[model samples]
Target chain A: MNISEERAQAWRADLRSSMKAKERTEIPRVHMPELDAEYRSHSRLEEVNLGLSAEQAMLEAKRCLDCANPTCMEGCPVGIDIPRFVKNIERGEFLEAAKALKETSALPAVCGRVCPQEKQCEERCMHLKMKKESVAIGHLERFAADYERESGSISVPTVAPANNIKIAAVGSGPAGLAFAGDMAKLGYEVVVFEALHEIGGVLKYGIPEFRLPNDIVDVEIQNLQSMGVHFVTNCVVGKTISIKDLEDDGFKGIFVASGAGLPRFMNIKGENLVGVMSSNEYLTRVNLMDAANPESDTPVFKGKKVAIIGGGNTAMDSVRTARRLGAERALIVYRRSEVEMPARLEEVKHAKEEGIEFWTLHNPIEYIGNEQGRVTHMLLQVMELGEPDASGRRSPIEIPGKTELIEIDEVVVSVGVSPNPLIPQSVEGLEVTKWGTVVVNNDTMQSAVPIIFAGGDIVRGGATVILAMGDGRRAAKAMDEWINKKS
Target chain B: MNKIVSKEYFSANVIKFEVEAPLIAKARKAGHFVMVKVGLKGERIPLTIADADLQKGTITLVVQKMGVSSSKLCALEAGDFITDMVGPLGKATHIENFGTVVCACGGVGTAPMMPIVAALKKAGNRVITVIAARTKDLIILEEQMRINSDEVIVMTDDGSYGNKGLVTNGVESVINREKVDLCVTIGPAIMMKFVSQLTKKYEVPTLASLNTIMVDGTGMCGACRVSVGGKTKFVCVDGPEFDAHLVDFDEMLMRLGGYRDIEREENELYKEALSSK
Candidate 1:
């Protein structure tokens, strides 16, 4: 079928479905997917939701009502044109909606899939005043982005003529990609250096494919490449080429967006056991290297009874991945109650649906190994929530003499990560915090060295993908003004 | 990237690369060391600065091929570059005028001790040097030590070289002959332990350099920790060089053995892959 005819048919379907449109609501309505006949029979990593059909997408879009002064955009970290994109979808211009999103977000497809829109953009929707369902903004956003990709002809933003201004970005994650894209639009020659063999720092390595597919991330990277940004992989800036060397190579400005990749371990007993591993290493082995394949060089251990320790989004992803890896039973061992879990509500719900057992109020004390030197079981201490701590959440206090032994062959530690100290160690005269994170002006991302700027996980230790992209946008603007004034 | 100031081969397994590092070369003294990585995927290994040239802005690193990382580094030629190199880290050696000082070097230890002997002689003290190895083939820096010391002795375990005994044997002979004011030893932990024990009988002050597991080569990681004088100290920032009599050699030896099994397995896997190809 012709492209225009197919779009026209979709528009007709949307118009026919407008007669059954519901009244505006206060709370954002969660979209439920109709189970696929074939996928329900077979379990695989394919996307669970087939996405809202064209008729459903239009009905959801009409529910937006196009607030004159939408506060939803203010809640978005990347400042995506929430109302404008929703308007495009209402008019059946799915291609234009994708373009509106790409104007700000460097990874719309990723954010649409994983971002917690209920807490951010959709939280401030006007429809929520009357306690009715708000528009399904996140689902529609994903539809527009996926439509553009499947169509194979995405509309890219036009770049200005090259101004011969060179800038170097030290990472290839969301922050680095955002800064590079913005700088390239302003006619600056941008080059991104990645320490690993593959690009997309944590996006490609930390998050599992079942949640964020590698190809979806690759498409976003390809879009950036199409905009005249160059990427050099396997080059660690602080080690392979120092900051001073970049300046000497005629890079007038440098934006260090090296995300925090160092894994932090609790100094408890049995932490150094053979079965214990950081989420960073385990996820990297599975996502980047295909370690699940038995024929691969680096095969990851597949345990029959696996226990993942933590309650964040990474914990959810790890537990779900273990289930897909043929583990008969998978569990999440967290110290806090279900209400205090750091994972998004939707993720927690999906994890429960996938048969992942949650052992809340349980903390691992030690891992016991067998005679042959392999983890056979773990000793866990039961706990209960007490008064709120500094983070405004109730802390878990151990209950004496309530320890239990749970048999498990593997344990993936998803506690947290720290900033990599490579950049601060290499650059002299730059001040770094005791945690090894670069110190920068909170307002402007500039460091003690006027020519260098840093942000993202390297600055904040750990943050969401959208927050990192926000820092990138701010650094690009600051850099552009600083360079223009100097000239 | 820094330029190579000088390069020389001390033995089949050891090579000294002198690179230009003005900041380190200026502040470096006898006992300071540096950490280097040959390239990406290379582990950080600590090496003592065998010598320094302030005028030429260079610090020398004498490396012996002991593991995978070091063997890869030893294979590099004169002009080849290392991916990263940092610091004249750890504490500088304590230099003072004791009437007479005896310096002992074993195997690769001769390279680092050459600078201490030279410094001790410059401090107006009588410096006696003893160099030992498993055999004559392993002994290095004999001529360099002779130039820096008032008297020099060479020993080997197999009796293929100077005196047929360990380095501690030479120390016993020197202690029995004269009243040594201070003794400095740099070698394996076991050798240093015995040297400290032998010197305890003669009532002489003994100093030894401790080699510990280090990651960042900075105080931030707290990996290179050791107990000295009944206090825990970070080797990277506190003292890679410490009083041999007060060091807890037993704890250091146990920590070094922690990763033996993993390393052996990795090495075996690496060899099998190489042989198959």
Candidate 2:
């Protein structure tokens, strides 16, 4: 069928689906099966969420009202065709649904697990308007992607004829991977340089195994690799090879996604103590280096009392990881109240179920260390919520003369992170903000250096996986257009 | 992949290897170092570039068997491939003719100091070298130091070498005798601390090369942050070298020993596994 005819037929199918709309609305949202909280918390290697069964996925897919407008697509960062994929699942064409997802998302499996769907697509579900729970869009998306991968019928997206124009990406994180995949499908020779030994930047290091397994990320990377994208590990772009070097080697374009790997620490006293470190260090050691294994070259210090400071997803990951490492008491000490936390509601709920203590409205003022220089205790200031701040969350103000000291052995700081300064400082003439993020045209994601572009945590400072992927996709389109126009 | 072309034993636990890395060798300078990973699971550890031959496209790395990563790196023979090596990291040392420069280094610290000494001598500075170790057998690169330096002084803790005192004693004697313009010290944190103290008392400008813990030697992780002049600085990007007077040695020492207990345990377990095989 021709393009316009195909679109018309799809719209007609959506209209015909109104016949069963009453039955579909009556089908309640399918509850996702999960590993027992107590059992899964201790099992560091096993995934917590047992993916939805095929039957469960189809029933859940039925719950989608298949709205004529499909506001869910507007909520998605990569703008996946929600109705097409959901309807594909409803028809039991699982692989077709995955193919529909792959048309936009480069790492659907990863985003399915880590993305905050409640705040995004699910929130926009039409069922919410009827005072009912939203359709399980995220869960169904995960089922479709997982089913396709496990069935061994993975499909490679079509690629255009080899344009043979060389391009490079600085980091193999979500943003870089997405950019590489899109550029490759456009028939460009793409190369990604990773400073770490492994790919999947934060997905491998910053994230723990129990939440998002390494194998899932590896499969996504393999898909990109099959698309003819090349990866060079242990290569620091600005240091090992300069931006000038890539140009000298005849690369037509470069994408700087060397994420915000620089972890931020609270500049409070005793932060430099032996037992205090960034969440990046703690997670990288356990997840990437196998530091839990005593025989590993670098073993993480297993503490009996661990306190992770912050209210973000990373703080949740750190506190949960500490629990798995045998901490007798694991706590999340956040400056603001639970309502103002930046972590996903699912993560917070899981952490509480795993017996993680929440010391909400408590901020660490100073860390006390023993003579041996290891963290021994934390001095916390009681905080109360005040007027809303710029981020629209209530600001936390310290209560005068109300403080408490708690004994702790280890502390993981998860305040936030600044951009990785390598690319910004190394690439001359590339404009950067006061926060060290590269200045790029919003429409194109192109930096002052016309041949260079940037995205991901390096551009957003700290953001979700899907947002970074969106940046990568946008940059690829802009880079391709710029290259074609120039030639 | 950088291949190990040659390996030589500097001492029982110390080793030196010449690896093939044309880009790193061409870009390297005196204070620049590389992050080397022995195997797929091995952690990346920073090692100073003792020397580099541009023509041969190779760089020399001196390894001391202190932990599992270092021991694994030292066990490899000629032709074994390194899974990963990325570098020419950190800012190069500031070289100039500061007349009468004393280069005090201990044990493995002597390796990173070799290039600085050569650079200083070529810059017309009369370099006085003080090489120290726990005993005579632990000392290394004596002939090379003697060839490049105007004078070489050996100090062993057990009095089995040139002098019977610590490195501080040798460095102090030189300062008392002649006009010492500058001092550069590298080694254990404790040794550098004392050398910095001695140089401060003599009012001589000094530089200490810090070997802090680092994950990605490209300023990604803040594991190698050190307090300098009351401000936080990343050793990977800000420096591997800083003014001795401004460094907080005690804090750096504690941070360096953050993994000491676990390291010792792992090293013992690894040795047991190796011996059983």
Candidate 3:
């Protein structure tokens, strides 16, 4: 055998021996440090998960089997080289591990924080087949990226020579940033236009700082900027400049990632009460605007008792925010039981620990207001689980004559959102789904108009950050090919 | 960023500014509005398109310093850059040669009336306008309204200026004098409600321009929803201008005051901050 192969075998033997000798082999997945429940319940703006230490990350990275066929990679939306990165961490190559992740993900730190790893990569781990605890991949990802960032030696990914082709990216969200990064990597001039004054579309405006800090998102965007991606803030694509105007300005291609910012409301009796608001507005006003501050020009309501409707990650966030705003009682009034909730289990656990009450199987029917026209109470109809619906979850059925009134000073509705229809309305002959999502080629993310393309919530209604980035990457590759053929 | 071309204050609370927005200038019509943001943390407030100079690529906006946002906008200098300004949005008023058209405007509402009056007169209809305010100092767009409309009448609540009365009294006079085909009122929801009630008695077809709490100024966020004829409609997309008789102003007034106390506290804080600075 060759000397390199012989050395590789020797290294494998040493690692296996060291792993077998330690009792850590039997240790379950490493636990992430969290804020004290009592302390955190009163505070709304501190990150609950304190993140993993280097020692803990090493322990989890060592648990990776480094399978010849990594199914975990398959489950990842961006198809990251999971085993390579994990093995890099095992070899003490922390910077290399981060580089490996940057090759696939535009926002490694963001995905590490918000992505549903338990449902994706972790679920497909080889240890799951043996009924053993899977490696803490998400935690390790966060650790490696954070380590590199804190180490003050962040190196942007390499890119090709400038090709001088200009591309327009609508909205600087995860999807737009991802697409811009890939296009810039291929030597194209990329410009991301955001309608809001600030960049990072929903990541900056919709998400609370306690969950995903603005600084982290800022660093990721900085990396893209360092790689030659230009950003133009306060430019709404359709209104500020039309698609035809973009074409006239000599942009070769356009990518729409404007996202679904629209908020939906239940048209029930007394919904027009002063205190009723969609979660989008509540979060945007609090997070994007300095509305939570009484000193800000636009201030949000600090309700004594706030009720968040629907059961999702946003609902949990709204309830948690209301608690932080000094709500004496923050409750989740959902129509379905806990089992049917769509929120990540970790968020649900965090909400529970923070003293948020979950009133499952209760659907709001009407709201009652005082003489001041502010909501004072919400009337709910008790619900029962019925047969499984098309989504494979049991549908909630209202129980007749079983109603109760919940005294609430505020109601934050987290029902759902439809795609923003500005681009669709501004452009002619662009196909859109009934749900207002832009119709596109699933493989290429190219819309019916060859000059235009779309991704993220504009194409998927609402989705995870990783899924949107995946669409952006696929669009980048396809756009590269299409542009090359055209040229 | 759009550059502010000129700014003039009409009163302690009312300010008129012309901005260079070529796209909006090209598309702006009567009864349309734009969403303006002063900075990254600024709240988006909709202002009616008071006038547009297409050749100069400028759109005029008249703002009243009522809340924290409007106060911030009023603090800007002529050469200052407005961070964001979207649209020429909402459906433009349907101006046809409906014989004699009477425009009833309240306070600063005279600004949005200028374009509608010009459009109706250009379409071969005689335009008669009633402009009223709390006091003479609060009245705006007087010369512009005069130049556009065939006839003009003015009033003030406390006899601080022209004939002492409300805008509804002027609407009654114009309807009684002329064979009014349609009446368009641009003012506060409460004022429009009163005018609509008067026009109903005179059997004058009336249109009321509405203002509501909005987020995106697009059809996306339903924050600016209003009930008209028992139907839910988004003001940003469907109709900012609707049949005055069909609109339920009570519901709108309640919804518009949703965060009144919070806004008041915020404005106090802003004033303190400015004073300290």
Candidate 4:
């Protein structure tokens, strides 16, 4: 046999032996350390998961069989070479594993820290067939990516010689950043325009720091910058500049990933109360500004009794944030059962662990306010699950003669979001759906305008980070083909 | 960014700018309004389309610097560009053969009222327009209204112009002399409410343009919403122009005051910035 094959076989044998040793070992599972006792921390933003130790990481990596044809790669939206990267981690080649992951994902660190692997890669793990716990793939991925960043061993993807083609990316969210990364690697001059003062769209504003640290996002943005991508903040595309004007400005193609920033609320009674707010405004204040800080210029209203209405990840984030903001009782008022919740399982679990109250099957009917026009309590109607709706989840039907009044000083509605109709309204003849989403070819991500492309939450109403990144990759490929065809 | 072709000061705090928006210019008609944002941080402000030149591919907007957002927009020079401008939004005015139509405009309302007066005149109606303000310095679109109407009456509360009284006094005088077919008013809620009440007594058809709190200028956000005839309608999409007699002006006035705290804070910041400079 060849020397390389012999070495590979020996390495595999060593891995299998270590894994067996770990299975026989009677060591207790090491729990994550608690926060420093002095820090007043009731929220999940304090980074409760201290991460697996080096020994734990090695043991977890050893659990992988390094299957000949790993289904985990197929499950990943970005098609990351999962087995190869996991094998590299087993060999203590964390930098190599990170490099392999970066070859497919533009923001490996962010995704590894946020993506739902239980529903994606780990769900397809072969070890599951043997009634054994799957390898800790998500944790290992995070470790590899984090190790690369901390060790300063990040490698930039090679770019071809500069091409004259210039593309404009609207919004600096995950989709836009991913598209810019791929396009820049193809040697196209790409510039991203952001409407807000910050660069990351929902990342900097919508998401709280505990889940995905701002430093991690900043590092990813810096990496994109190093790859020759130009970002211009405080530039609202449709408002500051129209799509037609972009063409006039010499941009050959435009990709819009503006996101669904427009927040939606239930058109119920008392929505206009002083303490009612959309999740967007609430998270923006807390995440963008230090609204929790008493000395900050834009201090948000602090309420002792806060109730966040929704079953999505945003609702979880908002409820946790309310807890951190010193709410004596923060609750999640959802109309769905726990199994039907739309939030990530990890987030739901963390929220429950952090002592967040869940008032399931209760829908707010109206908000009662004092004479001064401030919300004092919310009238809730109890609900019971009925037959499944079109979405296949049982609908919550209101129960007659069962009403309750819950004292709540603040109400954050995170029900859903709609597309920001700025571009669609400004640009004539661009067909938009009744829901205000930009109509695009699902395959090519191209809108009615041949020169304009769109994706992400702006197209899907609302979606996850990995799904948006997948859209970005698809658009990048389609945009490359379109530009090449024109030339 | 949308390019600004030309900017002219129509009054002390009011300015007119011609912007290159071919699509909006072509589609825009009288009484149609557009939402504009000056910069990234700027709030979306809806302004009436004062004029549109299709051949020149431009639309004119007359803006009165009042709130923090408007002041920021006014600070832009002639060559400066705005971040966003979306338009010809809300329902366009329905102009028909109302035999004798009386149009009343107050302060910046004259800009939005000018096109309706011209449309009424073109529809074979005898248009009599009353341009009213606190003083002659506040009155705008006098010349445009004169050219668009068969008769134009200028009024001021302080006796600084043609008639020395409120616009309702001028209207009452004209109504006593002739049978008014229709009355269209564009002004503050209080003024429009009084006009609607006066017209209701005479049983004349009245239409008033309601400028409520709007964010997207589309029906999506439902921020610029109002109750009309016991039904809720969004000003951004349903009608910035609605039947004054049916509108619940009290609710609209209440909604307008919803952001008073934010507005005051922003204004204070602006004043601090100006004084520091």
Tens digits of lDDT, candidate 4, A375-435: 8999999999999999999999999989999899999999998887667777787778989
DockQ of each: 0.08, 0.69, 0.54, 0.12
Find the candidate with the highest TM-score and give its number. 2
Clash number for every model? 7, 0, 0, 5
The residue-by-residue lDDT of candidate 1 on B1-277, one tens digit each, is 4456566787788788888777567667789877776654555568888988878888888888776667766767666676656666666788878878999878898888988998899989999998989999888888888887989989999999899999999988998898899999998888888888888888899998888765545443344555677666667666788888888776666545544655565556656765898
The digit string of per-residue lDDT tens for model 1 on A354-437 reads 778999999999988764446779899999999999999999999999999999988888887778666777789888998878
Model 3, CA-based lDDT? 0.86
Alpha-carbon RMSD, each predicted model: 7.5, 1.9, 3.1, 5.7
Lowest summed lDDT window (length 10), candidate 4 chain A: A24-33
- How far residue B52's Cα lies from its native spot in candidate 2, in Å, is 1.2
Model 3 regions more than 4 Å off: A1-25, B39-41, B54-57, B88-91, B94-99, B123-125, B159-162, B201-203, B219-221, B274-277
Report the Cα lDDT for residue A434, model 1. Answer: 87
- CA lDDT for candidate 1: 0.78
Lowest lDDT block of 10, candidate 3 chain A: A1-10
For each candidate in turn, the TM-score is 0.70, 0.97, 0.94, 0.77
Q: Which predicted model would earn the best lDDT?
A: 2
> Cα deviation in Å at residue B21, candidate 2?
1.9
* Each prediction's whole-model lDDT (CA): 0.78, 0.90, 0.86, 0.80
Query: A1-487 in candidate 3: lDDT tens per residue?
Result: 3322422555544664566523544667899899987787776568777888877787788888766567888889888887767767777788988998898888998888888899999999988887788888888888888888998999799999999999989989989999999999999999999877678988887778778888999999999999999998756777667899889999999999999756788889888788888888788777777677654555678899999998988888888888888888999999999999999988899889888999999999999999888999999999999999999999999989999998999999999888887788889989999998999999999999998999999999988888898999998999899999999
Order of candidates by DockQ, top first?
2, 3, 4, 1
